[model samples]
Target: MKAALVNRKMGLFLALAGILALAVAWWVEHVLHIMPCELCLVERWPWRILILIGVVDILLPGAAGGPVLWLAVPVLLTSIGLAACHVGVEWQWWPSPLPGCHAPHISGHTMAERLASMPLLPSKPCDAPTYLIPDLPISMSMMGGLYAAGILVAFCVWKYRVAHTARRIFY
Candidate 1:
């Protein structure tokens, strides 16, 4: 029972994390007027899935929900991987996997014509790194990688303790 309660709490934490990340992204886009690159947009999908999973875990019974929060472990690790790839792109370590990472040069088109063709809010190229904190060497992607890794480790440690306690109590 304690394990289940802890798991549910962790689920809520993961959900809040997802929401908070998304909220930051939204603020960056809408208020700050910063555009997210293709890879940046791709990185958000897992968080959306995590949010759904977290909510479900919070609502469901212990038998069904205990295992659900565990999914966040891999989901967060994969997010770390995605952010790492973005960092690599920013560093020019390798070519971007997504072609949309580079903006195509359009020429010979009239100004009005180009405006009609372009997206309302242009996506920032993946090669261009956005630094949320000024004067800090850390890019947003690097920060995301660190954040995910930290959360992953913390979640795993918390899970281990809960499992250890449950095992001792039950057996």
Candidate 2:
């Protein structure tokens, strides 16, 4: 009974956190007028998936919430990976796998055709890092990676405690 309550609370926390992360990203892009690179856009997907999982975890029966919450671990891991890749691109460690991260190659010979081939909105290059804070050296991707890692650690600790309690009860 207590486990279920804890799980529900955890789920709620995760869902809210994910929503906040997305909202901040949107605010940065729309309100702050900061353009996100293709890789930055790609990094948002895992959080969306995590939010869905979190919603499910909240809706499920208390006993069922634990396993559903477990699903977020892998999703968070994926988020961390995406953030790392984006950070790598920002660091110029390697080229971005996303084609949109690169400049569009207009092959059309005619001026009209070239204009049509051009992207509707100019894309920010992946290598360019956007610092959220004035003096902070950390980029958005690095912050995301850190946040994901922190959540992952918390989940692991929760799982360990659950296992420890179960062992005490069974043995």
Candidate 3:
């Protein structure tokens, strides 16, 4: 297949993968009642961004050429960074920021009110420092390592295809 065609195919695959990841995240949060921590929410953002980029690239192959690949690099890098940060938080290597999203509890509420309000608050806060996975001893933050690995794979594949095509054209 031609290089451009191959890149377009790769873009489509990446786009689909991103969508599936988002779907899984939703299922985990809404259906399984697994509340995501602040960092987990942050991690989802890059996946969404990557999904957007991949879909756009697939639809407009020319638009996703040289300049667009450069844009993807940062998106992938940001994903890795977020995953790393989550892993760090899980390991207690550093403290997470506290705020509405990361706040463990709200003041000025009765016990019943607090119980009722628990679901309203983001399920897990950054400072709480633990994630529960079914049948797993490790926390969800450790799962960030898996996310980082996946991002690295995607980045390498993208870079390889782009560079290979450039080299072929130049020669």
Candidate 4:
């Protein structure tokens, strides 16, 4: 026997979770003024996708039982990958994959040309990690991984039975 769920309710829950994740990141970045590295920004992409899926599923009744739920697995996986990469960079286990991580590109021949071409603010280095709480060993990327894992687990628990039913119906 399996417990039944309204797909729309599940979708709404997921959408709200997505929004809260982004909100936390934004709060840290904007209100707390903690800068993010390239990988940190990349980690948010999956959450953004999830938010979109959730919102769409909520608005369109037909979308709930469609392909939206299955997409969560891949998006969560992507988030995990991004966070792991960031963690590696933070720990000096490996170098960041981004070219800009090496250094900002200065193509200009002269110092003046380079200065003129440069933006007002340079991006934060990916090698360095920011801790949200003082004196804490955990880095932001690790927190992101934790967040992703929590949401993924919750999502799996929420939709496990429904997914099988969906597969049976579709295939």
Candidate 5:
């Protein structure tokens, strides 16, 4: 097959994978009521950006060929880093800096006010990781790790195809 055709195919696949990841995240958060901490939300942003990049790449194949891969590599790395950080936080290897999400403090108020504000506190502590599938013990942040793996795999496959195509054309 032609290099252009192969590139298009890979771009489509990446876009589809990204879309599926986003849908799953939404389902876990909205439909299943698995609330995400601030860090979890931060970890998700890269996936969202990657999905957007994939979509744009698919729509404009010429723009995606080489330049987009350069863009994707760093984004994928950043996502993996963020996911690792979240895992560290969940395991208590490191503490999260975000307030309200990572640390809960008693409001400065009288006893009556504290009693009235009891319901405002989150039921789940920020330190606690929320899992989409509780039986697996894998939190959404860890799931982001899975997504990063997919992105890396996609990147490798795409790179291989590009290199293979270039070799065929030149030699």
Candidate 6:
């Protein structure tokens, strides 16, 4: 019916949203050569989960898919929380939760000992925010938080419409 078609369309939209966010992140990191902090890397997990759930919902029957998409609500919330944490770190409101977000301090008396204690890989500090544009005044994490909030609002509206229509159909 019409409802099923709408559900499938929303599922596709949600899947594409996740894909777009990840794609931008990849492009920023690979194409632009901007390194991501540990917290930035951590924030992507919710999107990945959303992508999986959205794809599953798209594959399922319309009625069944609705509930699956509901699972994305919490995941989106988590993403928002992660983004806020990142923003806070960037603004110096608080330190990052991840140890990797901070530069490791190598303590040693001898040169050989200091060299041995140094980390093998380079890491970007979470407090240093990456701006996508020159002097944009908005960090990537802030933009991500806003994007997640928008998606959450859209999903809520979709669910509300579906529920209202169901009431009219049943009652």
Give the worst 10-residue stretch by lDDT in candidate 2: 61-70
The candidate that wins on lDDT is 6
- Model 3 C-alpha lDDT per residue in residues 9-57, reported as the tens digit of each score: 6667667767876887788779878777767787888778768777776
lDDT of 2 by residue, 55-120 (tens): 888888476777888789889999999999988889889999999999899878899999999999
TM-score of each: 0.88, 0.91, 0.73, 0.84, 0.80, 0.92
Candidate 1 least-lDDT 10 residues: 100-109
Better of 1 and 5 by lDDT: 1
Compare candidates 5 and 6 on lDDT and give the better one: 6
- Model 2, residue 45: what's the lDDT? 90
The alpha-carbon deviation from the true structure for residue 103 of candidate 3, after best TM-score superposition, in angstroms, is 4.2
Name the candidate, 1 or 6, with the larger TM-score value: 6
What is the per-residue lDDT of model 5 for residues 128-152, given as tens digits with 9 covering 90 to 100? 8877664899877777887788778
Ordered by lDDT, highest first, the candidates read 6, 2, 1, 4, 5, 3
Query: What TM-score would you give candidate 6 relative to the actual structure?
Result: 0.92
User: lDDT tens string, model 4, 126-169?
Assistant: 98998888899998889888888998998887677676876998
Error of 3 at 9 (Å): 0.9
TM-score of 1: 0.88
Q: Number of clashes in every candidate structure?
A: 0, 0, 0, 0, 0, 0
List the global CA lDDT of all models.
0.84, 0.88, 0.67, 0.81, 0.72, 0.89
Q: Between 2 and 3, whose TM-score is larger? A: 2
